[model samples]
Target: MNNVKNLNKWANAHTYLSLDLVRIALGVFLFMKGISFITNIQYLQDLISPIDKIGGGMFLIHYIAPAHMVGGIMIAFGLLTRWAIIAQLPILIGAIIVNFMGEMHSQNLLLAILILGICVFFLFYGSGKHSADYYFKMQQ
Candidate 1:
């Protein structure tokens, strides 16, 4: 009976924290992707210029790098998570579209889809209990 109760508790905890895990994973991915852009700016810019020109030459390529880094950090730390996810949506959507239109790399498409889904999940479910948002709320 005690073992059964412990198992149930463990399951419940896992279920409860799943959103946090998702947020963490998405954060890491976004951060790495942003870092890649920053490290390979000229290469990415060359690759992305055609798409950028198609959209009237806005700073989408230049802008998303910092947004991704900031949003990723916020989401990873569970600080202002919903806001961060909202900020990231444009980049995520743009990525999906670019991947769809470009070389159509299967792995890239799959990753973009997964990240978009995770962003959507956090948009609705919030940062969960294991976050800086929760900590701040508790302090109040």
Candidate 2:
């Protein structure tokens, strides 16, 4: 019981800094992914092209590129973090779906899940103490 208490105290103490780092890393990753999509739009389009016949595919194609770029930037800067996370969630889920539907390797699924998990973590943690949100709060 004492050990558990000590562990909990340690975790609480480190959680903020750990999560802030996570937010920054996740932001960088998503931003890079966005840039990849922008630079290689045709290749990505080919990947998603199969789903184009589906009802929502058109919508996804239309919005996903911008979402990645804009959402990625927002997340990286911790600007409107929650909303940025929300915007990116659908894109990540869509990628998961596409990978599954394409019969890609299990590792792809794991990677997507890991990335999604990080996004969800930031969603709940609110960008921690090292974000634009924190800076804005300080100014106000």
Candidate 3:
């Protein structure tokens, strides 16, 4: 669509190294969280236990870890970066909700909020000039 193309043009024109670094850091953080979830799945289950009572929590248990791992990699490399961030959106929103519905750990709440903010920013910002997306676009 013309709107999407124009948005991409605006985002690309406003690229910054600092923003790229932030994107990379956010990706690494998500990846690390995924790794942690895999290593200690019980923790993930416990976090989602409230949602389990409402149904389909078991499905999320299987979905979140792998999504984070793969999505994080794509985000880090700026390969389909927006799609990767979009995949992360649901998980992050659920994380924030879970924090409120349950015991509400300050650390978890803060981290989720920060990551969500960064993801939202990237949703609009796209990958910068230093990303795989830009490189591929240039190749075409």
Candidate 4:
């Protein structure tokens, strides 16, 4: 708990407008990806075919789109951003695994890795000073 508090303090001290913009962009990207999955579920199924063969892929299919959609919104607004990112972590990890397990599309793999990296960064960084999290904290 002390470690988390210290990390949050360090992150808050390092907050910048550019980081906030990047967080917003990341949120929008994830949201769009969710929409894409919903619109073309077959594409998502194909991507997850390797996992599907092992079973429980159906559950993941259902979980991914909605989590991304809702979590993306939370992340964008910096409302419970850490929690939102936590929810997304599994999906992102699975995305990377699926790329390797199945047919590897360089583009998809790269995108997943990049997004995962950003997510991990934000996990530690927390929302910046410009975010709803900071605004609400200030209000309190």
- Best candidate per lDDT, number? 3
Per-residue lDDT of model 2, residues 11-99, tens digit only: 44556766767777787777787788778878678767656667676577668777877877778787888789899888889778888
* TM-scores, one per candidate: 0.81, 0.80, 0.96, 0.95
Candidate 3: 10-residue stretch with minimal lDDT: 1-10
- Displacement of residue 22 (Cα, Å) in model 3 is 0.5
Q: For all candidates, what are the clash counts?
A: 0, 0, 0, 0
Once fitted onto the true fold, the runs of candidate 1 whose alpha carbons sit more than 4 angstroms away are: 1-15, 55-58
Models sorted by TM-score, best on top: 3, 4, 1, 2
Tens digit of per-residue lDDT, candidate 3, span 1-140 = 68767878998888888999999988888899999999999999999987788899878988999999999889899999999999999999999999989898999999899999999999988887889998999999
- Model 1, TM vs. native: 0.81
lDDT of 2 at 58: 59
Candidate 3 clash pair list: none
Candidate 3 whole-model C-alpha lDDT, 0 to 1: 0.91
Return the candidate ranking by lDDT, descending. 3, 4, 1, 2
Judged by lDDT against the true structure, how good is candidate 2?
0.74
Cα deviation in Å at residue 106, candidate 1? 1.4
Reference-based TM-score, model 2: 0.80
**Which segments of candidate 3 are over 4 A away from where they belong?**
none
* Residue 63, candidate 2: C-alpha displacement in angstroms: 1.7
